[model samples]
Target: MANTFQLEILASDRPFYVGAAEQLVFPTVDGLMGILPGHESMVTIVSPGELKYLVDGEWHYAAISEGFAEVRRDYVLVLGDAIELPEEIDAKRAAEAAERAKERLLHKQSIMQYYHSQAALNRAMNRLKISKRHNHEI
Candidate 1:
């Protein structure tokens, strides 16, 4: 059996997920990172992306925005500005958001608005991508 560790996910208000897992995969600012039990202690910035892990013989996925994780002594904790389950994503809403972002990008009256719109589009796309993949994994 694989070694297990206490895995916790925290957003602004409170803990979002708490459970035991053998491994975790989260999107770091630099790239994706993997964590295993008893792994080296470290902290890194996480991007607006998916976090995947195995727990209780099942895989789980969480979408997060601007977070970081801490690893130490068989425990891994993630603190993010926001987090959500894959199912919580509304496809239609995301699609509409993407469309709006694209429109804003095309009719850009301000540089800041244009770049921010681009980022929003990218984030919406990521959520859609992850949510779709999750349906297939089940």
Candidate 2:
């Protein structure tokens, strides 16, 4: 069996990461899902949350927005609406966004609007949490 798999993470604006990874873990609609090399092929809806990948014995993390992932035996592809490394996250901006999303939720709008607001809030909160955890670990 292979020890690593090709991992590619693409954001709407640009390619976020492309390299060989020993393992990968990310959020899905059902919950957290993990992938290993030589895994079965499948596709899944990725939820907004922290994405972790192991490369060269080190783990790297990123915050990813809603997207889809295509998994194959030797490769995986992630296409997210947005993706940001821990260092790239702005805690202050994320916090502000979270507050705005919360306010929008409280106002109560159409179902679509409510869903959007909830998604926004989830993304912002995930970013903030990841940013804080990364900073503290440094």
Candidate 3:
């Protein structure tokens, strides 16, 4: 599509995506945000959740970690702490991690530990959700 824009998803460990996307949807600390070609330029913090991108009339999904997004008129750059595609996610492993994180939360711990556990739980849940909804791994 002529309206498509460049999208680069940079994971801390590796580059996740580098291509033209017709549309984009990602999580933010405030909420979910969408971007399209010619959108205004801005930067916002990203939250762990399902990142959706439309390319060649197809919507792709990925499990993204906390980071930030830079939006521009002709491009959108996502600098993610981590990123996992559907095929990379293991349903059973994610489920087990989620359960472990939940159990950890049930017990008292330091503030940092609580936050770490929460982050783990959130990532696991997000991965499981995306895997089940998109990959039919339920």
Model 2, 27-80: lDDT tens digits are 999999999999899999999999999999999999999999999999999999
Which ten residues in a row are the worst by lDDT in model 2?
A: 129-138
- Which candidate leads the pack in lDDT? 2
TM-score (all chains, Cα) for each model:
0.87, 0.94, 0.94
Off by over 4 Å in 3: none
Kindly list the per-residue Cα lDDT of model 1 for residues 21-67, writing each as its tens digit: 98899998788999988899998898889898898778889778777
lDDT of each: 0.85, 0.94, 0.93
**Cα-based lDDT at residue 8, candidate 1:** 92
Candidate 1: the clashing residue pairs are none
In model 3, the Cα lDDT at residue 113 comes to 100
- The regions of model 1 sitting more than 4 angstroms off are 136-138
- Using TM-score as the measure, name the better of candidate 1 and candidate 2: 2
Q: Can you rank all candidates by lDDT, best first?
A: 2, 3, 1
User: Going through the candidates in order, what is the number of backbone clashes in each?
Assistant: 0, 0, 0
